[model samples]
Target: MAAVSATVILLIGVGVPVSIVAPVPQARAEVAQEQQRATDPAAIRLPSFGSSAVGVVGMPGVLAKRGPQAPRQMASITKVITMLVVLEKRPLAAGEDGPTITLGQRDVGYLDQVIAANGSWQPVQAGWRVSQRAAIETTMIPSANNYAETLAVWAYGSVPAYLDAARAFLKANGLDDTTVVDTNGLSSGDRSTPTDLVDLGRIALANPVLAATVRMATADEPNVGALENTNQLLGTDGIDGLKTGTYDTGANLLFSATRRVGDRTVRIVGVVLGARDHPTLDARVPAVVDSVVAGYHDLALAKPGQVFATYETRWGGVGRAVAAKAVSRVVWSRARVVRKASVDPITGGRKGERVGEVTYSVDGSTVVVPLVLDRDVLAAPVWWRLTHPLR
Candidate 1:
């Protein structure tokens, strides 16, 4: 490249042509893959745990199902819906239990039926009044069958009425494949698909009261007394609220997790149904999650004040175009940063004035950046202008 002379004075009666060219960016053979097969949710290895499915509600929105989509037994994960309906009918603010639900003779009868059937129990007594928050914790943490019924009756006055409300809630929330025949999930009648459960996890975590209640490893309330949460994976590896379920059908788990990558928080909601056992689910769920966490990468396509191209005039001027802002996003797929620069060489331009533009396309999303002049580009000297022959 020849040095553009700056000391040379413009000549009189002589016209000189000026033009500048900027190089276009090149993409590598391995760049911009159609999919990140290595870490894509569909491509990752899943444990053999009968019929299962996995999904994520995120910026990229990923979903994969390896088993049947038909409704299957969801076990105690039904409690998630139970808690959601309770909060929906009687909303609870942060740290607010809303109101007290007094246990009645009917609740005591529910208690007997649950205990006689060998369903989960949290020691509910007749005439015992507990705050709505405590009630949610009771049903969620210990997977209490009776508390679930007690809450439904307390909120809706009867099990049949509660089912009516639950059915509406399911349809309104777009959970078309899920139907709850029993609130406690003790009966095989309550059913959902692995795909539908992901949406269930999303709705459950969206409510503050229910989100906080399910994350507690142990509940120490007066009504429910000391009870441990069924989800043993809570507080591990960014895992938080949600519920777990197990029955003859198999083990199931719903999770809400957050991991930091670059400047963004990547939140993941995952559901897996039909694992061999609790231990198998504990191991397999995280293994599936690890694929997502590790795949998140800070894709820096541009930086503030970074010059992508330059232009020089053959007559006497030079200028550069720089990005005005930084562009970085958390991505799990291929990042192909391709830029097309359209520049106009000017006889004069003010510093910061847009002299060119760049179009950046990542995946299918496109962003246009205005390239501004990095410094003032002045016209040729007055003598050079006046002395130039009129063509």
Candidate 2:
């Protein structure tokens, strides 16, 4: 009788706890996958003339390129650099016109100077007072060469000083292929490759002042009245604010557009340099944009209530870990997608309890989906706990 009593105590002390509190079986994950597919670059409609490049905003590297990679004449697009450099010294906030400039004789002389040079010009009168925003508006909206120089002189006190600052800005931004010789691109000295121009376009779109100003179809200036925007592509297919350039070499356009891929909005930046004419540049730009947009698509990674892992216990309890909801991601055509699963050990749990997660990643973007039990995992029976001492 004493031996029986001792056995009972030992069983209660060790067997009961081992069965009730010992670690349960870990869930094993099983994943289903589909082969990844790549987009063909040959399918993209790249410009046949000059140099061109396109890239999605926030992603590194150029998505597509054509023509020679060497730097080419960029024409009026040089105004973009001037605007950025000047604004760096004189920052303009959204909805604010910034400081005012009083037009003097020398400022008025800019009209004749640019006119004689055969560059674009907007009318300015001596003693006319213009706000900083108005000056920028006059400079960019009409691609005015005179105001570009005027703003450059006003911001830096001389064209030479502005040139020094512009060079520094280019270097600091890693635009080694670009060179700025003047505030307006009228000088053959202003040159940049399609890749550098694409990066420059990205920078311009990042600035609130420039981004807002470039989208206007027309802006009313204090002295110049209403000036029309040179970028005729604005407002078409979501093409927004950006700069344009025309020179003896060829016409160039640094453009930005937006499109919807899956549930995400994607901004695209592109540049076409050394086009034969403005008409050719305009027609080619939209085609390039559409082709780039076509390269992005939504990939289905997982579906709702699909089993990813299974849980089996020594006590005969069973459960399945399933995705709680559907998961999908938007990715470029060449980007590769990968999946991983993680699960935790569990003895038993109520239905719909979260147990694990699955992650899908592509090109630095990631999506995580929760895994839950599809059925209840009941507690082990008392008989099993008492009989199985070491489990």
Candidate 3:
């Protein structure tokens, strides 16, 4: 009987079940996925530009969806980088003269063919010479490939050397995604992104000489009859200068505009790559600029503690009091507002005393400042109040 009882007890203990740990609930899994989607690059719907699009308003705001990662064949827009590289390495002072380039037999032959094919020409005769300024004007204004090649050869002593410099410049400027097979942007394989072009535009505008060249309506080359700027926005209100590019792949435009708002002057740069046609870009570019301006206008700078009408706190001896003034100022984007509150101890705050902190969030960024007790609370006590307290 004793053996039987021991065996039964052992069987009962051995058969007892272990508690199973439950898996995370399905709802929690769904929540986690939603959070991931918010930050996932693949999940977001970026705007579709055949190449790319980037528009910056003011100093720190980009109003457009920077598109997907893809290789794009940028046409003449490649010249923007060519110009940038040249300016950085060889800065020309105002009215500084450039080395005169006399046409080689090969250059002369090419110029004649290009001039006959299209009225656009750097117009170099075998013996004719030109200035760097004239060459730059032709290259930037009319997207002249002849002048681009000529300048490349003159500056670096060979077209290959000039191309090496161009690629090096692009890589140094955070335009790693770009590839330049040629200096003139004549090759369809020469590619870049709208993001890259916007950066190029920003760099180009920093050079006063380059800026002036792009803004000219027409320039006369020593031997080249005349070169006219193809960018129509030069004379337009609020638009000064920029470059334009087009090829069978698509049309690209880099537009820089300046507008005065009150005492502040704002410069905006817009890049649109791979439009169906020139007309489409002509309409879309201005709309993008208008959107950026509108978005910036809606942004506001808030005084600290504006999120709460009043904050009330208790004092052990003085009873309840409302904070008199807000803590600090906050600048926020036009998007939704988020507020957070905390407390700090000031000079007068006893243990556990409440000084205040208010945080305001704008466009995913936050600014936090302090709030202090009103001055009236610190005023001297009144003698009449001490004597008449009973009443």
Candidate 4:
């Protein structure tokens, strides 16, 4: 017989009692990351010319930029900003001609300055009565330099005041790289980059009055007998209303277009500067637009029945938590897809019960998915209930 320590308690009953506790189950979850697609800048052929710049921006931050940040002479593109600033201060109501302005000798005097300086002009007569709408068309469409100056002086009471307002407008809109000394963009002093112009182009398109006026090939006004749009590319390849500029420095064009991607229309804006001539500048407009629109495609992030988590028990029972269905999203090139998952600590769950959740995010957009059990995870069996470790 073995000797027993006095400190050790011995059970003298016919059957020694045993206490067993059911095992706890641990949750399991993992992120299944999807491979991201690639976008080659060279895939979209851009124009190679003297100091040219280009950029594209769309919904959900689909942005790609190229070319130098240097400020080039904006030429007539300055008129685009002139119109925008005017609209911001004096918004025209739908089907309304806006407030009336009687043309003074000064407005006509400015027309004489255009003639002496050899700037483009629409026929203007002193004491001519006109609505604000006609002046907007007379400013944007024919690229009329005198009407531009007239409209500016009318809006701000002086050319210096208008320039001050233009600078303030540029600063408020985050166009730090742009500066304007004139509303007509005739002077080499007016400067901006393709990136800034692209932003300005979008702002112009948002205004229905400005957008509609630019789309017209020609407009017959009471003061100006006939006015023709300088943008020949208007209404071509989804190209609509925009501004065109030509100067001793270089030619400039700010273009806006919309293309259908799946069930959505992706609005695009292209800015090209420093081309050889107007036709050469016009040719690259569609290329800049097509390159951006072609990058759209629907992407799949997750599939149905994909296991995202699991439930395991010490008693040898397990169940998988899976995605109930597939997930897809509309994305542009170089967009990223990321996932996060969490599982609840469940001792047991019936088949198809929810255990936790998973979230997928990309480009400031997110989608949540539920994690359901693939099979039932029952409590410990009778044998396990009797044979588990005693506590």
Among the numbered candidates, top TM-score falls to: 2
The local distance difference test score of each candidate is 0.73, 0.85, 0.60, 0.77
Ranked candidates (TM-score, high to low):
2, 1, 4, 3
Two-way TM-score contest, 1 vs 2, winner: 2
The digit string of per-residue lDDT tens for model 1 on 1-391 reads 1333432433311223331122211211111112222223224545666555555555422445566668888889998888788778988789887788788788888989998887888786788889888887888888888989889888898889999999999999888989899788998888888778878887776787887787789978985569898888888888886888888647888777777879987777877777878898888777766666666667766677777666565445667777777877666644455666666656567889886666676666787777777888765554454444341
Give Cα distance to truth, residue 87, candidate 1, Å.
2.1
lDDT of 2 by residue, 1-391 (tens): 9999999999778767777666544433344443344433335678989888988789877888988989999888899999999999999878998888999999878889899989889888899999999999888989999999999999999999998999999999999999999899888978898889889988998999998888888977766887899999998877886888888657888999988988889999998888888888898888888888888877777899988788777777788889999877777777777777777777678899998888876666778899999999876667766666565
**Superposed Cα RMSD, model 3:** 17.1
TM-score of 3: 0.65
* Model 2 spans with C-alpha error above 4 angstroms: 1-43, 313-316, 364-367, 383-391
Residue-level lDDT of model 3, residues 1-391, one tens digit each, is 9999999898656533211121211110000011110111112222255544545543442445565536577777777777766766666888976666677787876666556545245556677776777778878888887777667767777778888898788777777778999776667778766666667777777778887887788877666677788777676656677888877557777788776543456676777777787777676566555555444432333443243223222221221122324433222224455655554422132322335555656556676655444332321123322333332
In terms of lDDT, which candidate is stronger, 1 or 3? 1
- The stretch of ten residues in a row with the least summed lDDT in candidate 3 is 28-37
Kindly list the per-residue Cα lDDT of model 4 for residues 91-141, writing each as its tens digit. 898778999989888987988988887778887777789999999999888
> Which of 1 and 4 is ahead in lDDT?
4
Arrange candidates by lDDT, descending.
2, 4, 1, 3
Stretches of candidate 4 exceeding 4 Å from the true structure: 1-42, 57-68, 206-208, 215-227, 262-264, 303-326, 343-354, 363-366, 372-391
- Model 3: per-residue Cα lDDT at residue 194: 63
TM for every model, in the order presented, reads 0.84, 0.88, 0.65, 0.75
> On a 0 to 1 TM-score scale, where does candidate 4 land against the true structure?
0.75
